[model samples]
Target chain A: MRGITIGQYYQADSPLHLLDPRVKLLCTLAYIIILFFADNPYAYGLATIFAFAMVMISTVPVRMILRGMRAVLFLALITVLFNLFLTPGDVLVEFWIFTITRQGAQTAAMMALRLFLLVLASSVMTLTTTPNKLTDALERGMRPLKIFRVPVHEIAMMMSIALRFIPILSEETEKIMNAQMARGAAFDEGNVLKRAKSLIPLLVPLFVSSFRRAGDLALAMEARCYHGGKGRTRLHPLRYATRDVIAYLVFAAFLAGMIVVIRLF
Target chain B: MKLILDHVTHIYDPHTPHARTALRDVSLQIGEGSFIGLIGHTGSGKSTLIQHLNGLLKPTEGSVYADGKDIADAEYNRRALRGRVGLVFQYPEHQLFEADVFKDVCFGPKNLGLTQKETELRAYEALQQVGLEPEVYDQSPFDLSGGQKRRVAIAGVLAMRPEVLILDEPTAGLDPGGSREILSLIASLQKERGMTVILVSHSMEDVAAYADRIIVMNGGGVTMDGTPAEVFAQADALKEIGLSVPAATEVCRRLYAAGIPVRPDVTTAEEACEEICGCFLR
Candidate 1:
């Protein structure tokens, strides 16, 4: 089903999948920071190589990462085009009113590479780590925010459930669409307004059913004595291993290199 | 005319990382006006196979001829094909979204670009067919009970006037009495319309009681296809695929196994008892 495919965290015994999710989350943030600080062409190329190496090491199929990238290709291309056309810089080649500048090209390329690397790194974390584990790390890491009474645990729990249901909801959406189609509702054809209006049959039922499922799930959880964040113990306890230490050290090294490359080069 | 699938194969999202083949080289001809029950294990390609009937899914490497037209043709009118083959999905209540029963049931006819008068008329007729009263037409569908909601969903599909009605797990999550009510409504509707009714279910007893033909699917393949009696007679084969014959048929098989003079072909409990009594000399 389409629902199951979207959130399929590859279950593997690889080091990337086995590292503490908390460590992975921190490293992903640091990785994005390093990506942003990389300024020159050589630095961006190096970052790309590092990302590809990590993608391989994660043990996720290259085909899978490419599929995920395909979903965001449109946005990446748009960002690149916008930056290329809009960003003001010194002109290298003039064409009518527009100018193709070396600085603009460099900026646009860096921006494109930055966005691509950011998505790829984040996807690497998501693909290797289950949502449940991600939420567990988030809840535990955000415990410091309890001083402000932000309901961080509850927010993380809600996020975990939402992540869990993305596929479920997609499948439900497909069914609703099919039911509407059987009723002669044409989704693929028609003008924008007509197509928008055609979705009423699908959307109404989907919203109602989502609420119904949420209500039922809430009731079931209540019946099972699921009071929030009181004494909840996880079945799998997260532990920092030697790989986590090596990964964090590598991230620190990458961050230093990015700063040196941007400032000096 | 019969709907024929010749060596049909369907792969969901081909070339994607999660690409999966839901059906494989499945070939079958479902005769017109025949009540065929499609039984399958979960993820056995039953849903995938039925979705092809209406062109909701185009086969990756095969053809489905509906009313003698190849649905896989690039120029095929998919919307019109959908009108001819109504697919009532599992948990039909999940598709109920209109403000009232009348508007909901009329949704289908209206989509077909029928006149307002015709849509209203067809909606009323569909409600009547499903045993829903005209008085409840103005009431919000959300206010109805689970069984009523399901029937309303079914009526919405029937309002399209589909010649072939395919129901997927219609009795799921219903109590025994509610299941009977829904099944009887389906049977009566099929009889009145003389429509080709394809019931996809996991319950052996349901298929045994109503379907004239049974098709069993397991692990993305059609494992068995025959009349209900014939299919249920292959108890061992069904069991091998994580399915079973009807309880009555199993009882008959056990009785025959124990040297009792009862036919193994008896599928329903009533038929089993009559056969057992017939074997005993008065």
Candidate 2:
């Protein structure tokens, strides 16, 4: 349960940690978008260098980044397998009815690399930016959408509350599970049907308690006169620093390199 | 019910920047029918230590033995061990879920693979043991009052008929009357069933009133282990670790320092009252 890192911010005194969350958010978005456009080795190489440099600058442990990747590794493997066995291209190897194609191998490699880089690039942002900062950035970033009656502030408030609840809910889950387990509720050793049935004791109370918590939180927020984002002010408002500007320049250079590689490829 | 921890060391999030040594080479033994109060400051490893007693957590270093068998062994069944050492976490009422109190109580015995007949019988016995009125057993657990919900939660664990029961602040979030009632119920259960009860609490008076033995934890190690009177006698040391001596013991200590004849080891109000009356009365 502890292994699931929802609030991914790894506290550290480093450049990436100091970088403005707005910059980190935009950079991650840009990085992920550029990752999809990178079709060749040169483009991927430039992306890799950018990703690793951000990772190194973030100072979040390498193992943690890789740990976050483990969940997506299976999806990547499935993509590889699907491309390997099914992609129509020049045949590299032929068996009775199966054919391994050259294009399929290349596509699979690219897809796997893309998946790896996608998670790596995004984790660098999440691992450095606190949930508050990220949510704050999200709210501010989408402020322009308020013009279209998007209710950006309300959406962000709910999101921040949810992100805040994840760790709390997870800790509560562990407590309930342990409490139930102590009473001989075998959550691990059971068939699918039996396992789902075993969750009844754990889930019921969890839902009731979480709803109570939510109601309490609402009361607290209302007690403080929390109305939506009309005139509400944050304790720490987002602002771009020189370090953030410098980080943007570095990203710009990477993007230019990628554009060149895209043109060449 | 001979539960022993042999130099157990538990480190949470080990090898990470957030790595914390919650238990550091601490060892203790719990004999049958012993009501041991495990007291500690908030971060002093009391919770971590109790989790080891039931195999909810394996020690990063060292061993926990229940009935002379290593609970951490690959072949050892943790489910059965958990059944034997029932742990009631703080605010246990939060774990109650069944539509009715009786059904909720039966959850534990049912988990033990008991037949419906046996499970229902154990549930009835457990509810009675916790002093819940039979009429309330038919009501939904959620509909019950806070104290009733707490009793139902404890009854859930008791339905399993554990040899050793560890309650982490069973009376937390209760009124004074509710707290005393719950503690006395646990005290009586320990006396009647002869099951080892480890009460993890922050209250000095609660321990002094009920526990025969007190084990004090500080900074992830067992700093003091003795009878309540013996442990509470060191007022300075207990205060230094952010734990208090019982209120009665503290008053007696003040009296002793004031050149009075009151003994320094008076742990309970009754003892201090008797001593004071005997000293002053003709």
The per-model DockQ list reads 0.71, 0.78
* TM-scores of the candidates in the order shown: 0.89, 0.93
Candidate 1 stretches with Cα past 4 Å from truth are A1-13, A34-49, A59-91, A94-113, A260-265, B257-260, B279-281
True contacts kept of each: 0.88, 0.93
DockQ of 1: 0.71
Alpha-carbon DockQ of candidate 2: 0.78
Q: Give the Cα error of residue A53 in candidate 2, in Å.
A: 3.0
Top-DockQ structure, candidate number: 2
Q: Which DockQ-derived CAPRI band holds candidate 2?
A: medium
Model 2 stretches with alpha carbons more than 4 Å out: A81-106
* CAPRI quality band, candidate 1: medium
lDDT by residue (tens digit), candidate 2, A1-265: 8866887888898988888989889989998998899898889888888788878877888988998999898999999999888999899998998888999998898899999999898888888989888888999999999999999999999999999899898989998888888888878766999889888888997999899999999999999898888988878887778888998998898888898998998
Candidate 1 per-residue C-alpha lDDT over B1-282 given as tens digits, one digit per residue, 9 for 90 to 100: 468998999998898666999999999998878899999989999999999888888889889998788988889887777777888888766677888899989988888888999989888888999998777889999998878888998999898898999998999988999999999899988898899999999999999999999999987779899999889878998898899899999988988999988898988879988988888953
Query: lDDT, candidate 2, residue B122?
Result: 96
Write the residue-wise lDDT of candidate 2 on B1-282 in tens digits: 799899999999998767999999988988999999999989999999999999989999999998899999999998888888998988765578888888889888987889999999999999999999989999999888888888998999999999999999888889999999999999999999999999999999999999999999999999999999889988899999898988999988899899899888999999999988888983
